[model samples]
Target: MISACHQCGEPIPPRSDDIQLCRHCQQSPPAFDRTHAAFAYTFPINQLIPAIKYNRRPEALGWLSLVFAQMLEDRIDSPPELLLPVPLHPWRALKRGFNQAGLIAGELGRHLRLPVHQGLIRKRRATASQAGLDRSTRSANLFGSFRLTGTIPAHVALIDDVMTTGSTAQELARLLKGAGAQRVEVWVLARTPTKG
Candidate 1:
């Protein structure tokens, strides 16, 4: 069963009351209108993300994209006008040899028959890894890191490999909204559970 926060889509424990939104999302709304994660960032799925990201297993991206696409098909009623992959700093992209998010977005675009716009946004600078940072620090680190290039569609989906605290997605969504995107949705392969 997909019992999760109504806004962020983070998995929630089953309960009697029909509480939809998570406490954090209720207190402070995210820039994205909604989020959909294919799987919980746990156990085997967590291992797969690192393998595709750090281990340079570009071949695994196809499988991951298929899984995420199926999840999106099940959750979203309609496809967004455009797919915007969360960008990587140029330097980081060079070091990594590929942007995993971009690859996944391309695959998903092909499957969903939507346009994937790679150059719509660029990472302005490299920042510290958000692996161990708290929510506030993560938000600060990503501040002003994204720059929108040209016109953005009214509806766009921000694609990413995984969402931990959602700080990165939130930052990018804010930028997209500022650039005239009326509605932004976050689509990710997985979502790491957060502490309540």
Candidate 2:
């Protein structure tokens, strides 16, 4: 199995020694303290994620969440105090009839015996999908997009289905820390390989 970056959870090339930091994370760290992802955003698994997100396949979602929960249990020695699904804009949640992240978080929370807090952070406005956008554009699009609510916990894990450039996770983690969270970790089902 491939090793992952200790900070961002992106896959690292197989190596002889244990190097925990990826080059990008070493140069400039992310807002979150750490990340844990179950799989790379590739192959048939990639197809399954969209099917759960866009195609409204509950069975697929359940199975994927179970797999992710097992991965989390295997990797994390101590679970965070809470689980927070990356919030969706109200309009988007209404249109989709659900937030994919929330659905996954719900299952993970059950499996981990952690509380899933849905209202802790919310998207203030809808932004264009991060797909196909450059890293700078993705950051700009999410600027001031999330608002923190409720009491911020000392330790929390932000849940999402996929982490691509990690712009979204970065923005949310910054906000969480600003709102008094001592440590924020990201838990995602899959992570895309970093661009060269």
Candidate 3:
């Protein structure tokens, strides 16, 4: 496979320095150091992710996380000390009956033998749906929306179902790094080209 963005996992052209990074990453680096995506948020994945999120079909995450684990086996020479899932607001979690990111993190933890820490971060307030929002709006909406509930590990990975514009990852990672996390990586099931 060709090299991908070191920050967001989007494919990038080969360069003289051979840095596996996209122009966007070079211009404005994300808070997370690296990203690992199992699939693009397209076609079947677009459909499967909704079933797992809205339709309460967790089995899909099970299978997907397993595949993601298998894929990571080769890429991850050294695993992080902990797995932190992108959290949902209490109201959202209560209404949805579950946090998809938490579920994915649980499955990944079980397979990869990593510790899952859902309590490290908490969504402090509810925000509008990010589904159709622009990047600036999304960032503004999430500002100060999450707070740290516990200590953060120096080396950790953020787990989630999908990465749209990475606004959530940016917000969470920025918070984690500020709170003492040294190496923060993002592991998502899929990454969409457009912000979702």
Candidate 4:
């Protein structure tokens, strides 16, 4: 079985319990209070998520959304009143033709019966791709990249396909909390495994 941290959803370290945070999450707690994810970002998942993002295949995530929703149904006692998909910069959205997070949020909304609010959180800056960056670089790159375009609910969830370093989630959750969100949770299809 693949066990995960209750806090960040990263795979629990060997011999560790699931109720604790991973080392990284403990050292630098994420801005979001909790993370809900279905699987680790490995094997077929690593391949499938990239294809869904780069290949414009939102349809491929349908089954994954349903499965994650099932997990959410069992785990979430207090669900978010709204869902916000991490937005892309206008230029990035134009180039990609869609935001994968938005698509994933939409699918998840239907399965989880939450209202997905897009355009509420806008990516105003077009920073370089975060693929090869370290944690600090990734955090700096996202600084001031996001803008709140609309009001937010007190309790809300940020929906995305993957949670890698949690940099993006940290930035967005900070933004949301700053904008009056009392509780912020993250829901994702997969979370990257920790490097030993």
Candidate 5:
């Protein structure tokens, strides 16, 4: 399969096992500490993601988690104390019968032998999807959105399906920090390249 670089949109060979970003990412990096993704959010990924989300294809999760775990194993030093999934609003979760991020995070926890903690909750309900929203609007929509219940582990990793503008991760990290989490690492299945 021909996969393109998630950052620069350059053609990536089928054997490009060790690459996630193009040269551009090395030049200007994201705010998160470390990011490793299984596949670029295009082609097969684009097809698979929506299928899993809309069609309720839970079977795809095993392969997704395996790919994610392999990518993560090569990047991080060790497993974090806890894995925190980016929470969906209760209504959305109820409607969908599952949170996609939560399912992926649970699989990651099982694969990595780490604990999955659903300590974070979405305090604010968002009617608009984050997609197509500007960074400022995204920030506003997610502002004061996440709240942590009970004790948070000293070291925690936030898990999500994709990292786009990163406002969601940033806001969640801020909440985690406020809740006494000493460090936050983002574990995403894909990171959308910034558009030029």
Candidate 6:
């Protein structure tokens, strides 16, 4: 839980008490419909995640899932029809023991009492990471990379660990929309602020 504004140092009421945004977020709305981040991607979280992913710390997913579920409790309407984790290239999935986002989504589904659907796939060839790319380039990197397989209900919530440029979500949403999905919204664990 955030006790004060990250940028301005103003006091922030607990999410349960009052507030969706600190003064900063109020001034600048996020790109997603309603962004919900359990904690900023800094310090322990940033360090711990890489260690967990690289060192095979599967237990961390449990804690991450619990925090993400609590943060999203108020925003999402009764369990989404489906929960879809952003897909990773097959090679990446192989390199990493497991898809962190998928693990998080699975835990979230369990907590929220929803079905976790793993029907979507990364159809495009693997490309460079999005860490250093501009918004346009980020979109280009993810373009045509995702395709839905099997059955997908009309409404599904996309899940990811961090939402930065939002290009990944945008592209995925575009594909889902094209495939007759009625509506698609992203539910990420973190939404990074725009940096100039």
Which scores greater on TM-score, model 2 or model 5?
A: 2
Question: What lDDT does the true structure give each of the candidates?
Answer: 0.88, 0.88, 0.88, 0.86, 0.73, 0.70
Best by TM-score: 2
Estimate, for each residue in 59-112, the C-alpha lDDT of model 5 and write its tens digit. 788888888897777767866898888988888877788888888899999888
- Of candidate 2, the 10-residue stretch with the lowest lDDT total is 52-61
Clashing pairs in 1: none
Q: What is the lDDT of candidate 6?
A: 0.70
**Model 1, which residues run further than 4 Å from truth?**
15-19
Clashing residue pairs for model 3: none
**On residues 16-119, what C-alpha lDDT tens digit does candidate 2 reach at each position?**
77778888898999999998888888887788888777877756778788888887788887789999999899998888889989999999999889999988
C-alpha positional error of residue 101 in candidate 3 after TM-score superposition, expressed in Å: 0.5
Better of 1 and 5 by lDDT: 1
The residue-by-residue lDDT of candidate 6 on 37-56, one tens digit each, is 57666677777776887898
Q: What's the lDDT of the predicted structure labeled candidate 1? A: 0.88
In model 4, the clashing pairs are: none
| Model 3 local distance difference test score | 0.88
Off by over 4 Å in 3: 1-3, 13-17, 194-196
CA shift of 169, model 4, Å: 0.5
lDDT of 3 by residue, 1-196 (tens): 2456878987555667867877788899999999999888888999999987898777778889999999999898779999999999998998989999999999999999999998788999999999888888999999999999888889999999888888999998999999999999999998876432
Q: Which portions of model 6 miss their true places by more than 4 Å?
A: 1-33
lDDT of 4 by residue, 1-196 (tens): 1667767888875664444677777787878999988888889999999898889787887888888888889989998999999888888888888888888889888988889988899888799988878878999999989999788899999988888888999999999999999999998988988676
Off by over 4 Å in 2: none
| Prediction 3 TM-score vs. true | 0.94
- 148, model 5: CA deviation in Å? 0.9
